[model samples]
Target: MARFAISDLHGCRQTFLAALDTIGLNKDDELFLLGDYIDRGPDSKGVIDTIWELERDGYRVQCLKGNHEQMCLDGTKDPNWLPIWLKNGGRETMGSFGDHMPDEQHLQWMEALPHYLETPGYILTHAGLNFRRANPMEDQDAMLWIRRWSQEVDRDWLNGRIIVHGHTPRTLSEIKENLAYLNHLPVMNIDAGCCYDLPGRGNLCVFHLDDQRVTFMPNRDR
Candidate 1:
């Protein structure tokens, strides 16, 4: 079975589907969505529903919370959080949920998502983990939202598994050539900024863990 990781969907339902099609996913394949599923696009609801459906159909789908999702959850607890979230394409996310605000079910689902997922070879996170934090659990904020600090920190801080993260969009995928000794790991950034229009069209990154093959589906006219 093939295993894959992707991130920063940003509500592009068509592109998301297209990416899956390009990857030729099978029933046994596992897909890890590195969060930011909703926001910045016209079909946030469709995106969420599609993922839920995929999971129901026996596809091994794992989801993690992104900063956007955190903002959505926080908005429910504090009115002030709404503006910041909305400004960052959160209005679309809210629209996806319809007139109904987040209820217990939604909160429970969001809260249940882990900040980081670890496997023998890779660690998946929305944002890179804080290198300085001795324990990942001790710093949930940085785990879900850190950017510069995570990138600038020495790679030696990463422990064991290769850290695969999305956030801090880059023009191209970054694969570190060297590994630091802390945990003997390298960090990789795969968010190709699919929602933003620049350099190239929207991209959905696909990684084949077993084969070590990485490919991307560029934004195409729908």
Candidate 2:
């Protein structure tokens, strides 16, 4: 069975599904979603529904928590975070639900999502780790919101396993240029800016862990 990872879906359900189809994902194959499943695009509710259905049908899925998901969860607990969340595409997610907000099940699912996952060959997370920290596991904020700090590190910090994460969206060329492979440690970014509808942006990316293959599905909204 193949192992794959995709990230920064941003409510683009059609693109997400089409990318899976392109990868020929089957029941036995594993899919690791690096998060940002909601907001910015047209069908946040549909995206969540599809993922739940996939899991119920026995599809293997590991969905990580993204910064956007944190914003959504925080908005539910604190009134002050509502406006900030809305300003960053949470309004579109709310609109996708029509009259009501996220149900209890959805909230719980988002709340319980783990910050990171580690396997023999790869480290999976929503955002890259804070390499400067003594223990990145303690830095939830960096895991969800980090950008340049993780990308610019000159030395390999993962020992040998590569880091596969999303959060900072880059064009295909930019990602290729920035992808690091030094001392057997690689840092791969696959966000693709799917929410941004501009030329180089707005494309969903899927990376196959076993074969190191990268594939793309253009955004439907674009």
Candidate 3:
């Protein structure tokens, strides 16, 4: 089975679908989505709907939690967090819901998402690891929120397993450069800023692990 990974969809539902199509994703393949699935761009609800549809149709999709999802959960519980979350793309997310609110099932699915996943050959997280800790896995907060943690990657702890992650947006060219050196580099960030309509951004990237391929899909959702 082919193992693939992508990150930071950020509410670009149609773009995400296109990426899956571009890769010719099938039931036999495993798709691991590194977080930030919501907030920013449009169709946050639609994005989640696609995830659910994949599951319903027997696709093997694994998801990690992102900082925005955590903020959304907190904002749902406390009025104080509403402003902070709204300021940070929550406004557009709420707009996606329109007349309805996120049902319990959706919230539970997000809440139950793991912060990271470790396979025999790679470690996947929403954000980079905090190598400052004796065991970087102990820092769950950093998994969801940290940035610039690449400089601190504990090579000894990582051993030979490549660290795969997203949440930090890098340009498509930069991502391709990383893919080219996947054999030498210990970490790869696949987020091409699919939702951002700026220079060097706005393309969703898919990383096929076993095949060592990169699939690019433009943002037509926005």
Candidate 4:
């Protein structure tokens, strides 16, 4: 059985599917979706539907919560949060739920997602770990939206495990500078900016843990 991880799908259904196909995933392969599954694209509904379908098919899919998902949850608590969520590509998410409306089941699923996950050799989060906290387990905010914290080098954190993250989109090469060390354990960023253009192309990254390989799938956008 193989294990793989992906991040920041951002409702790019085609790209998401393309990545899965490119990776040649099997029923036994475990897929870790590093959050941001919805928003900023034309097919948020499709993204959710596909994820749900994948789960039903016996795929061991682990999904984390992203900042966008947090905004959505906050919107339910405070009506004022709607504007901010909408401004940040929430329109697509809203459109996806069209007429269906948010339900208890959906809310529960979003609410249940953890801020971070620890596997045997990797730690997964939407953003990165908090450096200020005396203990990494104590900080929730840092897991949802941290850039500077992940960039810093700490031998303790490095020796802990590989940190796989999204949120800050940069090329695989670009991540080299953001990382604290080059020779030691490395941080892997899978965002690749499928929602926005920096490298001017929408792309999805696939990391095959067992094989120690990285694969890329071009977004359907261009």
- lDDT top scorer: 3
lDDT of 3 by residue, 1-222 (tens): 889998988889999998888888999999999888888879888899999899999999999999989998998899999889889888888888883446687789889999999876899999888988888889999999888877677777888889999888899889988888876668899889998998999999888888677888989796
Between prediction 1 and prediction 2, the one with superior TM-score is 2
Best by TM-score: 3
Off by over 4 Å in 1: 98-104, 150-160, 173-185, 220-222
lDDT of each: 0.74, 0.85, 0.87, 0.77
Q: Rank the candidates by lDDT, best first.
A: 3, 2, 4, 1
Write candidate 2's Cα lDDT for 73-131 as tens digits.
99999999988999999988998899467888888998999999887788899988887
TM-score-best of 2 and 4: 2
Model 1 weakest 10-residue run by lDDT: 173-182
TM-score of 2: 0.93
Candidate 3, position 205, lDDT: 87
Residues 1-222, candidate 4: write the lDDT tens digits.
Answer: 889988888888988888888878788888988888877887777787798999998888889999888887887789899888888888877777783435676777878888888787788888988766667767888888888665564658557577788888877566434343534645777777887765634677776665445676777843
lDDT score for candidate 3 against the true structure? 0.87
Model 3 stretches astray by more than 4 angstroms: 99-101
